[model samples]
Target: MSWLVTGGAGYIGSHVTHAMCDAGIPVVVIDDLSTGFAEFVAPAATFVEGSLLDGALVEDTLRRNGVRGVIHVAGYKYAGESVNRPLHTYEQNVTATLTLLSAMQRAGVEAIVFSSSAATYGTPDVEVVDESTATTPESPYGETKLIGEWLLRDVGRSAGIRHTSLRYFNVVGSGSPRLFDASPHNLFPKVFDMLYRGETPRVNGDDYPTPDGTCVRDYIHVADLALAHVAAARRLDDGLPVERVYNLGSGAGTSVAQIMTAIRTVTGIDFEPTIMPRRPGDPARIVATGDLAARDLDWTMRHSLEEMVSSAWEARRQAGDTYPR
Candidate 1:
């Protein structure tokens, strides 16, 4: 089946593109290269350089390629940056989604796998959040993602479109050697960059309510996350549900200290990190309850913390410099 991936040159999107290619699926990619690199797009997939806000471009690309389904991964993602620039985040994350949905409707595409985030559930009252958890986004990035999910849900309620919103936590690891590209915005890549420059990684906060007094998150390997998308695509093809949402995570909370330890252990970098105060809107712990995803999508993450860190390190190493430098 032919597919279109909106942010196909991005970190997670590139992995998804590679996964589809490995499965012998025809794919078309559209990326604006804002944060994504064109080199990361899989060689097997057709690439279009443009933004999702370009509705005409999105529509033309979808119709021309005979795209049966779309995996929407295009948008702004930095939590801290979103807080500093709410309007930009809303425009890119929320407004762009509205345009994309309109374009999808125009193209008569019936299936979509939206890339959502755990941020939508914003500092859940429960230690582990599931699909049934209440959403209270603390950042514009999170709020916009939730808005995108709502748009899909509303559209699905009235239109013939079927959707699966995958709310991700900390998406780690690299896909293939060719598709591996690092983002400076993420924790692992920032740490990798610091270590590469013979500098110690800086931890934003060390006084959270967690065991290590630091924020905790569920880190899922990017490859496994992509596989989960594939599973969701298969389920949609089977006509199981018109609209569904699943939180994609490992169900294990890894703190900042644990991440630092993993990086040093995996990369043989014996460096200490400088701890500072917690950033605003930082959650103490944000783990996932992937039971629903496991039951419905039959998804499981196979890579460990060490495996994910090592893959990211290898990818950074191969890049010769931090991506988008």
Candidate 2:
């Protein structure tokens, strides 16, 4: 039986699909190619172009491929933009996930690894967040993600499905040149687009209480995140214990200033970042503890700040127009 990876054409999902294939697992992908590119899906995996909203299509894909598990990474992921489109966000992230879970139950696929976001904790008061942190999402995007988690838990209780969600913040870098961050809202691609167009990168705020007077945020390499998903899947397959949720993070995070310095060094650019006024509700620092993940999900920060910048820069340069259109 194969593993079904929804949105396997997306940056994170594509990496997970390829990583699962690397582990000698047969993989089947279901993606609508909405924001994701069809080219990103690995040839080794069977690809089905469809939406998660189409329950019959999803169930057909699962049954046709003899899928034993699911890795759900499909959703509308822009937090700020979600404010203007809450209905779309809820439909894609919540309603779509419900459809997926229902189909999985009907098909008897009992395992899943959900791709979640740290945005679930809206401006957390704690310096370092763990699974126990309160979820007070500040945006529709985040609210939907938390709702997705609740759906998973409720379904697990009713159907005995084995599942876990990995909550992460500021996912950056790339696993390969073939894959790169494509979101217009993501920091890496946003910075790369600015620099590539010979424009100076702007720091939104620099007067925060962080060590460098800029926001300190966790930015994990996509490959590291993908590996954690692989570990979660393997444990579920092997009937090993796994947590309800894992925070994929580096305990100590990189600040905006640190990111600027790394970009300057990696791209061989001698430009200093331009500073602007702070955006409202911007926190000084928000990081997460990966101790639980390290113990159970094989999570680790395999790339340093410099390595993350370099790898992301290379992939963005390779992506060209794919970065920002």
Instruction: Please tell me which predicted candidate would have the highest lDDT against the true structure.
Output: 2
Q: Candidate 2 residues 1-325, lDDT tens each?
A: 9999998999899999999999999999999999999889988999999999999999998899999999999999999999999999999999999999999999999999999999999999999999999999999999999999999999999999999999999888888987888898888888899999999988998889988899999999999999999999999999998899999989999899999989998999889888999988888999999999999988999989888889889988998875553
88 Cα displacement, candidate 2 (Å):
0.4
Q: Estimate, for each residue in 1-325, the C-alpha lDDT of model 1 and write its tens digit.
A: 5899889998899999888888778999999988788888889999999988889999999999999888888888888789899999999998888898899899999899999998899888988888899999888899999999989989988996899899988888887655564666788878877787888889998888789888888998999988888778778878886337898777777898998888878888788899877787677888897877888777787888898888888888887754537
Q: Clashes in model 1: which pairs?
A: none
Per-model lDDT: 0.85, 0.92
Best by TM-score: 2
Clashes of 2: 0
Q: In terms of TM-score, how similar is model 2 to the real structure? A: 0.98
Model 2 lDDT-worst window of ten: 316-325
* Positional deviation of residue 284's Cα in model 2 after best superposition, in angstroms: 0.8
Model 2's alpha-carbon lDDT is: 0.92
| RMSD to true structure for each model, in Å | 1.5, 0.9
| Off by more than 4 A, model 1 | 322-324
